[model samples]
Target: MLRSLSLLALIAASPVVAEGARELSAHEHGVGELNIAVAGSDLVIELHAPGADIVGFEHAAESDADKAAVEAALAVLGDLSSVIALPAAAECSVSAAEAELHIEGAHEDHDDHDEHEAHGHDDHHDDHKEHDDHKDHDDHAHEDHKDHDAHDHDEHDHAEEAGGHSEFEASYTLTCAAPDQIETLDFAYFGQFENARELHVQIASDAGAQAFDVERDAAALDVKGLF
Candidate 1:
């Protein structure tokens, strides 16, 4: 099956794709997005949101508490009933669902930190050996060495400040016995996550394509006639 991003590319070919892309890229803290497509009895929905909206922060889930929060959010996103409510009359069941926290630049930042530590350790060892060999010269360079260490510490702080922020992505596939019976999609997401204030929705189906800005106050999408 196509991944949600690939599916997004497919939707991008449609007329409303530009607006959808713009909304997602804006990355407003309390805003989220949903892309829905219906074809026959198959329904696909992709959800995207800033990490802050789901987990209270956008940094990588490094600490145990942060990691736990990410897992909890993923669990909720993966469960269809927890995040969405479809028409019961449609007799729909989930076929597949996936959720992930995408930490931008995390791997690159991790690799850089590892490499810096290794090089720093080796350099320190080399300096120690040189000091033993040339005690007099090393004593004279002690002040310069302190200055270099201070510079390195400042650079490390800057690197930490540039740590990556995260976002959540979820995709779901459902099969309905009666496609035409689907009239509305009620989102329980706002109740699950109080931080989520708005959902920018785009839908494509047999009837046509349409867009909506669903707010926390009105969390349901009127999907009548889409099938």
Candidate 2:
């Protein structure tokens, strides 16, 4: 298996891919990025796509339906043959495959946020406890509770409006018996993920580097002599 970082570093050396990397980094909906690197008899591919294009939603999987969609998408992504087909003469077989979904939100920082909230709650409780009269303390606490509830409701509304951003990433490493026999890479990714409409591909090989823009209508990357 090729080291992912090394493979990406070699691909990044391609001037076209390097220059366009910034534009490809944008999390544009319906657009996906693919990087291909061929070294000796090994071929490595990395795919990056917005969660919206993969699962129809870019938020955390909170509901059963959302979770199911994420699972299905991952399954499809993990299947290397479902995404790209190599020339049968090349005799390529996937040696490694990985796929994952990531949601951008407070989820990753939940522990820190929870700690802060707990500290603030303790402070508020102590302040209420210091009151001389028990009934006065109860009434004040009740009002404060209502205020907190209202604040939380406003936050929830804002979060809903902002929605959530997520993405899917997959990587594959394949070994080919006859790498030079590869004439093209037929992408079936667009058909598998209905929301994926465009694929920006970058290729790096001993022959040099090249780039191609593939649309759903034409999803083949010609690599007749690249290897």
- Relative to the true structure, how large is the alpha-carbon lDDT of every model? 0.72, 0.73
Error of 2 at 203 (Å): 0.6
Range of the 10 consecutive residues with the lowest summed lDDT in candidate 2: 104-113
Q: What are the C-alpha RMSDs, in order, of all predicted structures?
A: 16.0, 15.9
Clash list (residue pairs), candidate 1: none
Per-residue CA lDDT of model 1 for 137-204, tens digit only, reads 45534543444355445443433454544678888899999978878889899999989999989998
Deviation from native of the Cα of residue 224 in model 1, angstroms: 1.2
Cα lDDT of model 2 by residue, 1-227, tens digit: 46998888787778866554322135789998899999999999999898888998886666889867876788788888888888899999998887765443322334433333333443443444555345445565655554544443444444354565667878899999999898988998988999999998999888788889999999897878787
Pick by lDDT: which candidate is best?
Answer: 2
Model 2's lDDT to the true fold?
0.73
